[model samples]
Target chain A: MATATGTARTPAPAAPERPDRPGPRAWLSAVWPSALVLLAVLVLWELAAVAFGVSQFVLATPSAIAAETWASRELLLAAAWVTTQEIVYGFAISIAVGVLLAVLIARFHWLDRALYPLVVLFQVVPKVALAPIFILWFGYGLTPKLLLVVVIAFFPITLNMLVGLKSIDSDLLLLMRSVGATRNQILLRVQVPTSLPYLFAGLRIAITLAVIGAVVAEFAGASDGLGYLIQFASTQLDTPLMFSALILVSLLGLALYYGMSLVEIALARRFPHIRADVR
Target chain B: MQSRQISAEGVRMRFGSGSAAQTVLDDLDLTIRPGGFVTLLGPSGCGKSTLLKILGGILEPTSGRVLIGGRPVRDAVGDRQIGLVPQRPALLPWKTALENAGLLRQIATGARGRTETAQAAERALALVGLADARGKLPHQLSGGMAQRVSIARALAMDPAILLMDEPFGALDAITRDEMNEKLAEIWAATGKTIVFVTHSISEAIFLSDTVHVMGADPGRVVETLDIELARPRTREVFADPLFASYSGRLRSLLEPKAAV
Candidate 1:
């Protein structure tokens, strides 16, 4: 009994691992096509810019942007560091608060009635439009950026979590209750596990938005960040610099998005029923 | 070992009140003998599931009460004395067959000693002939195998009374028959009382010592017939005149209008 409790789901006598799970070879096969597409897009954009004799101010060539990016690597990297902090902090806060609110709302009908509309209202309002208000309240700092991110990113988390909690089959819940499971037992064993796929779903959406939110927050007013770099470069009319900063922003979003997918994939290994196609 | 006799008295289940009130069950009373195999046979919308839920302590009757071995239904459930197998397999898709079967025992905070409960999972799986399939996940299992794992889960609960609501209803005829045999084997091996809910006449006759034929609107037991058939009923029994007679009687009981 103690051993069973210790390792919740390990087969007793070393059962074979799931054989059909994709390996590195499978992943490479899956990923290489997209990688090739990206390379082709870059090559085409570079050729188009050179052949058209496009002014650098109108559209910097891929090489010019890459050169500018390398030249100002130190400054851009520093701005990336600041932007990374804002997005990470904002994303984290959104998840924690969204999950907490979802639990409360799911458990209590009164709370669902009272607080859910507020949640929806927060979600429906244009968060970028509210950036100015947040700046006015918290000033041009990390605080305003995070508030906007949280305001923008937490809705999907809360809504998805709530749906997950309530979407169980009636028969399943009845079976759980019949087994003498307490409320907490049902929550921990059934509700929590049921909500995980939704958690990942919400997380995927929230992380991407968090990046946008961080940039928007900085756009409102900030001393330093990729967003600030864009504004500064725009004022100097340095298209190469502006293009490089935008590329960094895209890279940040891609990195965060990819990191989340990796985590989701790891989780899906343990809970194989979590469909990768939930998106 | 003392066996639990499940009994219900004056159990009335009504939803809503005033002119809008709708009754699902009314003035229903039942007594299931210890170590007996009983069947609740009824059509759809006949409150069979509701009655089963009431017996399992998953629902409270609008009036009256139920007892298992003289203990209240709620108390029995608290001790994990009532095991339920809903129509759906309800397996945690993430868990392998063994882990899913073992789940009830793991979550059951019953007074049974540690060593006793530890082997319950393995014992139950072996009984259901799933000892080999324990490593397989829910998605990998066939409909019948998944159903067997759920049976194993209920058995692992070590309950006094097992409440199964149309467990094989969703399967094809061949798979359903196979499951019926598997269930019959389990019931014979373990003398635990079982109250199985179903709408199938042959099924009621094949596995049950007594069949409680139920009626639809405001569901109530219209008739209770004891099957004096010999022990270890098999496919051969399906050809017997006695089996045909029992089936005819149950069919009439289920659909009086059609019979008329």
Candidate 2:
């Protein structure tokens, strides 16, 4: 047991060395193909709109949309900021509530049985249907929009958290228990750390859905936001402006989604065992 | 740490309820002296692992009881007198080798500080010849390396008794041999009572001072043989004439039970 060869034994195949992180060249190589595809699609759209003599009101060319976006830069930027704020606030609240409820439900069987069905039902019901109700209750302020975002975004987070908490290895649990570890110790030291990957998975899904929720709530009724701006542009028969607003909404969603990814990456680095896989 | 005596008094374990219930371990009785190395050798479904669990106080017997250090097994467990190594290493993947080794310190005292806990773990790792690999994660460890870490984790507690459920059952033949030799050395040095469970006949004969051959289908000990081999029993012992007799007797005892 005290021999040097015993300590010098080779690592098992099951426990392979950690993979190297992708370098700058690898990053550029991955990005450029997708970038070329997007460029090609834009060129095709511009040619199709011009060749077919499509009216700008019916289908604006990519160039027309870009020009309109540049002309209304201040208005678009301000609206994007409002929608971005709603997305961030609503997303943060959703995460907090979702994790809390998940813990409560997962920790107690009776609570889970009582609330799980109702949660599933709520998740199934089109959250857009609740947008008008939120508007009725909270009026045209940010509260209604934020509530709508929470309702839509909270389910995935809750379900994923439950999955994560419950998915611990039975053997690991037994190992901890054999050492006389208390219930709380087992939970905090074992279960919570094990569930981090699943939690991140849910966060990615919830974040993207939050952007959609904010847009739907704005469509129902809002004084300012990309969704409201899109509705206004549509009413004025300004197709290019509507497209620009739609573009801004997507851009906001992309930013928030990648923001979650960045957090996930940093966390995975800190605890490499739960390296959250890219969604 | 000095060794502790362990005994199971007519222990029985049953699964299910009423008439539909099946007995896994029935009227099983065992006793081990302090500083003894004993192996419960049996085939699969023999409930050897279940018996080990009962002795460790992780599972209560359906009837009867286990006693360690002249106290109820449950009490002994409460005092953290036993260290158990299951079939798998079961190390927390998020923790490094040293951290995994020191896990018992946290459980033993609820001590959240890392400094003292780390020193204890480091010492245990060195005993298991894994001091150099302390910083590696479980994923970076080989099967034998991971098992060594698990053993170190148990040793860090300096428990009175070590209960292993086929700790090397997953390793290749060569690694298993190496582990057996290392375990023998640890046993000689520490003199801790060890109750190991394994199905391999040669394994039982090689390391154990006494082998309790257990029969399956409601597991119970069928025979016990005192290994009269000389001290520092090495690989060359396999060539000894007495070793063949012990192996033959153990095999004969197992075959008749297996046929039933």
Candidate 3:
């Protein structure tokens, strides 16, 4: 048997200084340059269109898109609202279904093995290809669109939550056991809290996918939404309206992404140790 | 405080399959008196920790029986009187120091109320000199502080029997020494029966009332040495001739090719 060494007495070094906290002015200064760049790009695009004598039918100016947006303010807002509703409803359903599937899969290894291949099959098959079939099956209704959104949004959450639940520290489990903690207590106290970081990571990814899924389904067959508006403008050869609708879609996607990001930030702030990598 | 006796008789442990079965402990017998700080001192793979696990009711012997206060320990689930502190601090990262300490009471008493548990946790944290850091998470704490939290958590249970498996093994020498002093103080105040497992001879000698030397290859107790040191031992006591003599004897006992 090897003798134990008592001489491994190295002291840990002092932790390095954290960077200074940025004030509000510093934060504003950081974003000011990006705003300037955006302004420069818009000005250049508008000027080049006029200078080159490009037809407004083919390439819409930034101002033209803005004018289209202002002229069709009610239409644009209604479409945005419709898209937001689908995204929010789809995202919420995806979370509930994903969490349930993840819990079931985690609880039963055989079920996980059996259904995992099917889940992979669903994820791998492009939603664009599936959209037409979904429309055929469920008709040109919200049901097919919502189902498409669910499909796109569910996989990331299910995979991430499973990984999180399974990756709990063994020592913590042992500690709980040593304390005579019940199985329920172990799950509630240790497993769930430990998985929050990974769960949030998946939620962020899934939220963006929810919007993409909705748009794809809308593109296939829909009477309203920015996707349908974009398609309608394309058929009429109204480039400015198409650009305006496309801009609105991009803004919608950005809003959803930022909303999820803000939630992650709030949770991270509340549970700092859960997000140790953030700093 | 009532004096309770802890005993393990003819304990045996085996792991793995038929052909590859490896025995960890064989026919190990030991007894610890109430208020006695007994250290299981041995080389690595000597099953000192395995013995501690059995004593703490974390594991059951394949054969023989373990008794605490004359009650058999066949299962760990129903027992809340034994407190265990593992080698790693194992403090819950999400919970604050006080919260971690309070978890023991919650586990033991099943949440009658949080107020009493909170008070006990506070007292335990203060006893470990971590009152100022009650709001800090495990990651926010230094390693020494984290270990202290683990100690506080275990102590907050107010168990009659405390089992520590190399609780300060991961600390630096200075931190280890400080922890030893703190443990000694806590032990003095509580008068709890402590079964500390470690491979360090000096540490065993310094903290224990009696040290059980173990041997591997189907591990068993090879020897037990009594330290006749006075109570409330200080750092200066380590320099005394009697302490040196006891340590040398322990070192020699462990270094064999010698008598059991």
Candidate 4:
């Protein structure tokens, strides 16, 4: 969209004088707003906790949560490792199965006709509610948590990828036909490459869902995990540890999100011309 | 495929079945000779683009035939004899300008060696004054530059005929004029048969050797005017008295008249 206006707006001669790459300070500039907001929120919470004389069990202060996280960092880290495994393994399975299902659904009209409504029904079945049943059937091992993760995370991938495959400009299709391109050529050249952005979009949503699913499964029935830690700490009236576990869970999700982004960026750079935004 | 004479003989195109059917094109008959530059000029709903599509073998006519070089449209298309540029550039964002330009030669048939095909695409880019911008991506170039790449993509195939559907319609007026000048130059340089579709009278007059004015409401050709303009038409031709006369005649043919 900026193509027409870009050349007209900026004179070409000035490009040589401009910096080719962004400065190191650019990263700091980008993150400062969010960091400032987070700092302000933490300070406000600590002040309110002290001024109101709230019980530690009710609401742990920011300092207490931080200190507790550092003090028992080993145990918390171990539990975080288990939950991280569940989330990562579950997400990988979701990507494989979801992308396959989407391709199948998009390729065959009869398959789409038969499976779309069923897929929608599965998505709306409330995946978290099924955790107890899965745990009951599969035992309190990693199987139930992984199953829960797949159940919750797979839907968005299939939905976004299928839309991407099906969504092509009609004019582009005509252009392909005019050139007498084969079906295989159109799929490989146009559909699949164009679908990268949508696929990445689905992955972004699915990764978060995978985390939630694993934690919720641990909540329903689990011998280990960050969710189990949270339950144990709450019962022991140790809110600081509960808050620490929660922080770890959030950090795990953040790490997965940025990790996927990095992978996408690397892939985009290696390809014919896929952009870093995955478009 | 090499003869380059494309003709639509008694072609009829209908959109739907039974009473709900709409005839988008009806018994349309026209021929474009080898190395001729023709424009299908009309307002919206005149089925100019549809005719171009039928000629390109992208859409099959409901009743009647479109022949290229005295053979079926399909045969010509299979031989890679038809090159089309749509209204939108439709350049894949993932590819560089050069890659996008050479896409058809790479995909339509692998008969040509990679080196030869790449050189052909590069030559077409040079014809369109885009040799320097070949490394740029679609988003890096201006709208006119992107459309020029599309033209290069079409020309890369060494097709006998070129079909363009308002290739410059999306561009700004200044860019469009620049493109027209470049296109006139390309036509003169290549001497490939071109069937252009557009609603702009000035464009039809400036670039076309023959303008086929079309009428809507059961779309059909109404008038065919031969342009007497010389080769390599420059911007100064816009000031010529003959140019104004041609535009005046085309405008009268195009605009709907109100009943007294």
Largest DockQ belongs to which candidate? Answer: 4
Ranking of candidates on lDDT, top first:
4, 2, 1, 3
- B1-260: candidate 1 lDDT, tens digit per residue: 26488889999999988999989999999999988899999988889899999998888999989988888988888888878898989888777787788777776755454555557878988999988777776766789999999999999978777899999999999999888988999998988889999999999999999999999887999999998788787788999999999998888777656544
RMSD, one per candidate, in order: 3.8, 4.5, 7.0, 3.8
lDDT tens digits, residue span B36-129, model 3: 9999999889999989888877787899889877878643335567778889887766677788888877776777857788898999999989
Candidate order, TM-score descending = 2, 4, 1, 3
Candidate 4: tens digits of C-alpha lDDT, residues B126-180: 9899887777667667889989999999999888889999999989999999999
Scored against the true structure, residue B61 in model 2 reaches a CA lDDT of 93
What's the TM-score of chain B for every model shown? 0.94, 0.95, 0.94, 0.96
- What is the C-alpha local distance difference test score of candidate 4? 0.87
Decoy 3 TM-score against native: 0.87
Q: What is the TM-score, restricted to chain A, for candidate 3? A: 0.85
**C-alpha TM-score for every candidate:** 0.90, 0.93, 0.87, 0.92
Q: Per-residue CA lDDT of candidate 2, range B1-260, in tens?
A: 33367888999999899999989999988889989999999989989999999999889899988888778988777776788888999888767788899997667766565677778889989988987787777766789999999999988887788999999999999999999999999888888899999999999999999999888778889889999899798999989999999999998988853334
lDDT of 1 by residue, A103-166 (tens): 8897778999999998888666787999999999999878999999999898889999899888
> Interface RMSD for each candidate model?
5.6, 7.0, 10.1, 6.6
Among these predictions, the greatest lDDT belongs to 4
- Screening candidate 3 with a backbone cut-off below 3 angstroms (N, C-alpha, C), the clashing residue pairs are none
Candidate 1 Cα errors over 4 Å, as ranges: A1-52, A276-279, B1-3, B110-115, B256-260
- Evaluated on chain B only, candidate 3 has a TM-score of 0.94
Name the lDDT value of residue B216 in candidate 2. Answer: 79
